[model samples]
Target: MNAADSSALVVFSGGQDSTTCLAWALSHYERVETIGFWYGQRHAVEMECREPIRQGVARLSPLWASRLGPDRVIPLDVLGEVSVSALTADLLVASSRTDGLPATFVPGRNLVFLTFAAIAAFQRGLKRVVTGVCETDFSGYPDCRDDTIKALQTALNLGLNSRLVLETPLMWIDKAETWTLAEALGGDGLVELIVHETHTCYNGDRRTWQEWGFGCGQCDACRLRSAGWQRYSQARSWRVWD
Candidate 1:
């Protein structure tokens, strides 16, 4: 399928990476829609930021505004009900004893997300599904791995008997490169929108405003974002200096 003419559905979480992926989709595809999930996350505020981010992204370019389609929010509260993690519960964020993965790793979260995204894509006749799951500069979630996404993509296509394409624009890149990609896709405005509108705090603390964005600045998510922003900013500064 020609990506320039294809339609895509983005699995947006109103976070930095997903928002970047959304911009990437809008830049590449002819039509792009977004789908968010409410799994009773501790940082449910991310859902609230979805619409505003969509509007902000659309305002970036007339082409994007024209190509951007409707948004959908799926109620996957069952995942939260069935899983015990720092993201779903009030427990402190740490590593698990068995696998050393972060406590924020909601088991099977991405798997279920991709499955439902496929269903939504099938219903909407969207041939491509975009996600922001990354292995680099992430909290070590197994489902976010490239291998896992590829496997799930194969399973989804076989189970649905459809030619749905799973797209991960941020899979191999780190957070700094993610920022760079967003800038490349939409320029400084997009970066500013991501910093001001997107929510990535695992603690759901919208109170503290960091240079990277709004976050508690202490959680794993915040640290990754902050570090990435620092690297991204420093790199840009050095380029300007050169």
Candidate 2:
């Protein structure tokens, strides 16, 4: 794609991967916009978290507004009737396997988000979409696989009135690589940006994360993120982890 056509949109969640993707989008695209899903998942808590996220992005890089505009954040309520995700209920999102799509899969979560992002991008004359859907360190989510993403990309392009490409920078990269990528972009400072901001709790416990922004520390998200933090720490210290 030409430089001007490099404009893109990111499926933002104010969470770890999405926050990183938000930063990545700011750096990668000539024009970058974002779409945030507002599916009924613990409303007030989630919305409260998002306010600071938007402000954080704006404070860190005002150019984000220049590219995508600060008001472009879309709060979509698409998965209202769907009672499929743990993020909305008390049942823990079970095993990290793929025998079948899990209840926590959030049925059509990414599909809905991406489709909307594509639609928004198409309308705005933007054609590239970026998301941070990593299979590694992810809980064996079917939606995160290369095939799923490719299929979605094709479906979006064919079904939409215009063409679009969904870019997944963190698709193949593991948590460690994600950490490395963040560092490459902004160094340990981005690590701080990640620490103070991103939410990775399955139980939605804010207390567990007040000081360090860590969740249960055992869920797939926290474990993977911890590994990334440790690796970055060791690299900085050059001291063997014991």
Candidate 3:
């Protein structure tokens, strides 16, 4: 990307991945804009998590706002239409991870979000877009794969005809690796920032860091976060001796 033309738009859910993506965005793009969604998720606090991210960006070294300017925090309130998530129901919320795709999967969610965000980026005269979706932690989400992203990128370019680059910074990184990358990119406190500050729980519980910023212990989000933090924390401790 030309330094003169490095403006970008990021799909930010204000969650652990997205917030780290935002910080990563600030490092590369000359200007960064954030696009958030409120797609009737079972837990509303996910949207509210955007606040600390906004604050974190403000506290960056060069200052995120100074680089990205003001971001567009879009709150898409299609509460009734987006009922595909397993997080929408009660009983299933406890036992819905056995299937191939998993019920917690939101139907066409990232698709819709990225499509809309692409339009937003185009409208703003920006050529680049960043998302934090990862195949490493997809569990079963088809949209998080690099193949899917690349295919979508091709179709989007054909339709838009203006060169829209969709980049997934976390495409190949697992949860522990993602934490490591965020730390490498944002310094030592990156993992803490994501675990304690950013929210990704489907149950919307901010009860403790043991869940590792994910919603509930039962959900996939919580499971991934739980395992990752455990491994990362222990590995960090061992590294202190090495």
Candidate 4:
């Protein structure tokens, strides 16, 4: 990749997926910066894990430490004020009766995140924005779909009149593949960082420690992570046997 295409801004949320994406970006890009949003999420604890996860990821490899750049936390409380969802409010974690989308699906969250990430990337002279919005094994969020990201990428480039490429390394992959990807990017150290430092429970329950990570183990986020970890573990065991 050319120097112009080598820097990327990752939309990090200090969760398993975002942290994995951060490692992936650090491994691939010459320079990788991270941006997080404080949108009044119920799981606001994830915000607290951001720095620790970054520091842990950097310590996993000298190359990653050298490539990691400054981190930015943008306050987007407006999103919480406007959206009525389990992630932003004290609401029941269930599917919407009308739209069939999960209650944890914050409307326009990814769109807004990517929009701000684009602005940050533009100012920082970063051409690519990396995110971990996977369609597979997700909560059926419309904004997380591949079509939405592609459209937004085109719109962002046109609106800013800049060549800003939005990259989703986890778009088609399942959560099991995501864990494998993280291991591939930074080995067992990266996975350990994710397990010990990342937060994903919608309720922000950091007190409970699952084998996969810290979560309530009942919310959609925790369930997905748990299932993925089981699958990944089983696959790894099978490979070892083979």
Task: Score each candidate by Cα lDDT.
Answer: 0.92, 0.71, 0.76, 0.92
List the candidate 3 regions with Cα displacement exceeding 4 Å: 1-4, 63-65, 79-83, 88-91, 97-99
Instruction: Kindly indicate the candidate among 2 and 4 with the higher TM-score.
Output: 4
Ranking by lDDT: 1, 4, 3, 2
What would the TM-score be for candidate 3 when compared with the true structure? 0.90
All models, RMSD in angstroms: 1.4, 3.3, 2.3, 0.9
- lDDT string for model 3 (1-242, tens) is 57547888888886888887888888888888888877667777877778776776667565665886656666566632655566554536545455567777776777878888998988888778899999887557887888888888888888888788898999888788777778877786656667677888777877755646645676778788778777877787898889
What's the TM-score of every candidate structure?
A: 0.97, 0.85, 0.90, 0.98
**Model 2 stretches with alpha carbons more than 4 Å out:** 1-4, 43-46, 61-65, 71-80, 94-103, 210-212, 239-242
Q: Residues 1-242, candidate 4: write the lDDT tens digits.
A: 89878999999999999998999899899999999999999888999999999999989989999999999999999999998888888788855647777888888999999999999999999999999998998988999999999999999999999999999999999999999998888888888899999998888999988899888888888899999999999999998899
Best by TM-score: 4
| Candidates 1 and 3 compared by TM-score, better number | 1
* Candidate 4: pairs in clash: none
